[model samples]
Target chain A: MKEIVVISGKGGTGKTSITASLAYLGGKDIVLADCDVDAADMHLLMQPDFGQAKDFYSGLIAEIRQDDCIQCGKCADICRFDAIPVIDGKYIVDPLSCEGCGYCPRVCPTDAIDMLDMNVGKWYVSTIKTGTTMVHAKLGIGADNSGKLVAHVKNEAKRIAEEEDKEIVLVDGSPGVGCPVVSSLSGAKFVVLVTEPTVSGLHDLKRVYELVDKFNIPAGCIINKADLNPQVSAEIESFLKQENIGHIASLPYDENFTAAMTQGKTIVEYDENNLNEILTQSWAKIKQIA
Target chain B: MKIAIASGKGGTGKTTLSTNLAAYLAEKQEVVLVDLDVEEPNSGLFIKAELLREEEKYKMIPQWNPDTCILCGNCQEVCNFHAVLKLGEQIMVFPELCHSCYACSELCPTNSLPMVPQKMGELKHFNSGTLSFIESRLEIGQEQAVPLIRQTNKYVEECFSEQVIKLFDSPPGTSCPVIEATKDADFIILVTEPTPFGLHDLTLAVETMRELKKNFGVVINRHGIGNDEVEKYCSAENIPLLARIPNDRQIAELYSRGELLYKKIPGVKEQLDLLIHHIEGLESAGER
Candidate 1:
């Protein structure tokens, strides 16, 4: 099966909205995976009928037994995150602050600390309105190991795609050049970069593009909110040309985008004529590559 | 008194509010502005400060010695963070994952492991005339922000005397990094716009500040363009609304040009001055 991963270099760049529109048009021919576990919002727009929530253990969370401990202050001193607290002459680990590094347990001379593999997140295999299977998850607040969770979601989606003989897998990846983004881009057929017309947007896009280049992924760019700053939009186009990246399309600002989100619907369902055509044509062009 | 300008979502003007507040406050009193968003440190975009000093700090992690090492795997088994992973025959260390707890070193059967410090990032001190801009730049692709933030606190404590009034530019989110930045701040100014997402995230920020037990007030940015959910939240929570800046095109243009908004908009300075004075008064009184 062919694969396409859509990502943006920055947050709030309209990656999910456009990805959902493409998924809507593509229908059951593909499987959808939202790998932005840190802030999973596609479910709000797609209204996916989520099913089978499984407790996912990513990293370990240190638990110190206060009764079995001495107030040596070694664990607190060694904890790089300051996750451990000195309370009433005792060291206690904040579940949220803990990175599960297990270093604290070793430093405790009294051996009062033990590592606990905490349930840090949950994953789901659901169906969006377009009759396509979707795998998405949420990383627990203040939790690490997002890259592992993304890989897990992608593996599940790939299994379903192969089982159903789907021809393509559409993934809505996270923003930035982080571990989670790396997992989403792993072995993907193509990457569609969505960006805006701003200095922050271009700077972040360049950063993420360098990462995509590191993986040798063939990529294209979609300049969203192109009209917001035409000068920046032109600069982005020139940058794309200089970098040998494909420029897919430019999108104008529309209040309907926000309206659709407020109504808990994809932009395609709200105004299928304009932006939907852009994704449709882009998908068709992407299909010709392989 | 320390005041942290924080927002739960990025691009909602965290840096914009913090830098302008710092610039405005520096005119009267000693002001220390901290850029805690180490992931993409940008407060220096406006505050032109001279480099004073720089230091490199790291989170301590157990360095395993192969000479005295036994492959008992006790350290690997005992580690909670999975920061230490025994892959095939080689032990791999993900520094970003390490919290420097020294567990592997203490648990090594052959006494082969020792906790050692490695440079993870740099903190630069900048003196811009009156305002002191303290910024910590974490190494790129490094996920150990909390450690750097902890180190950042040490720098702030040393540079910002108790008498100085400071404004800390916190990273967007109610996450661990934001928590680390705001833990010592005397007051928090939650900067937010008016939208469903804004309101949703702001509520989370408020919940976090409340849990931290820090005195907080709301600052409505782009006031008239959005809705009233944020105002209503503050009213119901009994948190005071400190200031409001309307959605003016000129102010937006100024920000786009990398200009400080408070200087461009006369409306902003008066509100900030009032807010700063009120915070000082509240701090002296020891009242929320």
Candidate 2:
């Protein structure tokens, strides 16, 4: 199956809006994957019927046994993160500050510290309006290992696509060149970078392009809000040409997108129908290139 | 006092609010704007700042010497990030995955591994008219940003003065990076729009703020463009409503061109002024 991951290095660049439209137009044999675990918003538009979520276990966390604590303060002194705290006459381990390095356990003479697996987040498989299996996740507030969560969601999407005999996996990637974005692009067949026409957009476009380039993935650029600044859009076009990345589409600055989103719909599903033609054309081009 | 402008969702005007608020606040007080979004720091692009200093941040990673090694594989076992690997007789080390916990070198039986400083990112200091700015730029392909963020905040804390009002432009999302950036802040400004996505992510951010036990307020950008769900949610949660930036094509265009709208947009300066007073009120109330 072909995998097309939609990414924007900067947030709020219409990655979800465009991805939802594409999934709506792509019709059958498509599995939608929302890999923006840190801020998964695709479900807001698709309004999927979510299934039971499974807990996601990531790195270990240190927990000190209260009964065996000797309050010698050796673990506190050696911890680089200062996770171990002497509180009220007993030593305690702060789960938020612990990095699961397996260091504090070694330094503890009383063997009180035990490294335990942490449930960092949860992933779900659901059905969207287009009858496509949508795989998404929610990373717990203040939790780490978003990259691993993205990987887990993608793997689930791939498994469902295989079982259902789906032909394509449409992925909605997260913002920034961080671990989660990297995981979304891992082993993907193609990448469509959705960016805006601003200095931050241009800079983010370059950074995410470099990240996709590192994985040697075939990628294309789709500039959203193209008319906001023609100069920056032109610069973005030239940059894509220099890098030989395909210029897939340039969507106009349309308020219809916001209107559609506010009504819990994609551009294709909205009653206004202003953004339908451009969105269909973009999906056609994406399918042809991807 | 340290105030952080943050949002669970991206593109909610954290940078816009921060840069403009800092510039306006500098007119009456000594202000410092620290952009903690090191992965994609764009605050530096909007502000015209004079270069004051730049320094490279580094972390210690174990460097294994093959000559002194017996290939015991103890270092490989102790590493949590899988930065070290043991082949038949060779050891492979991946520096990018290292967390600099020094567990590998400390656990090495033969003392073959030694800790060495490796470049992680850069911290920059700048003077933008009356405002002092600090930003961290992580090297491309780098995985972790918390260390660089910690180092930048360390510098800010060391030189902190009683007269300066510090504003932090935090990264999007309620993950570890956002937690690290806002941990020490006196107040947090959660920026959001009025859409469903905005409300969804704003709920997550509120959970984070409550977990941190930090006082916070909400700023609604692109108001009148979407539904009233966000305002309703804020009222239900009792989060103070600070300001509302109108949804106007003119404002979007101004933002696109990187113009400081506080200077030209009608009533924007006054709204920001009111926001400053609201924050001060919150602080004074907290003290009482």
Instruction: Specify the highest-DockQ model's number.
Output: 2
Q: After superposition, how far is residue A151 of candidate 1 from its true place, in Å?
A: 3.7
| Candidate 2, residue B77: how far the Cα is off, in Å | 1.4
Q: What is the TM-score of chain A in candidate 1?
A: 0.94
Off by over 4 Å in 1: A70-84, A104-114, A272-290, B57-75, B81-97, B109-119, B225-227, B233-239, B248-252, B267-281
Best TM-score among the predictions, by candidate number: 2
lDDT of 2 by residue, B84-129 (tens): 9998889988987888887888778888989999888899899967
True contacts kept of each: 0.17, 0.73
Q: Which tens-of-lDDT digit does each residue in A1-290 have in candidate 2?
A: 99999999999889999999999888767999999999899998887898767889999999999899888888888787777878888888887778889987888888999999999988889888887789999898888888889998999899899999998999999888878888899989999999999888998889889889999999988899999999999999999999999998888998888889998998888944546877888888888888
Q: What's the distance in Å from true for residue A99, model 1?
A: 2.9
lDDT score for residue B169 of model 2:
98
Assess the local accuracy of residue A48 in candidate 1 as a C-alpha lDDT between 0 and 100: 82
Estimate the TM-score of every prediction. 0.86, 0.98
RMSD each, Å: 3.5, 1.3
DockQ of 2: 0.80
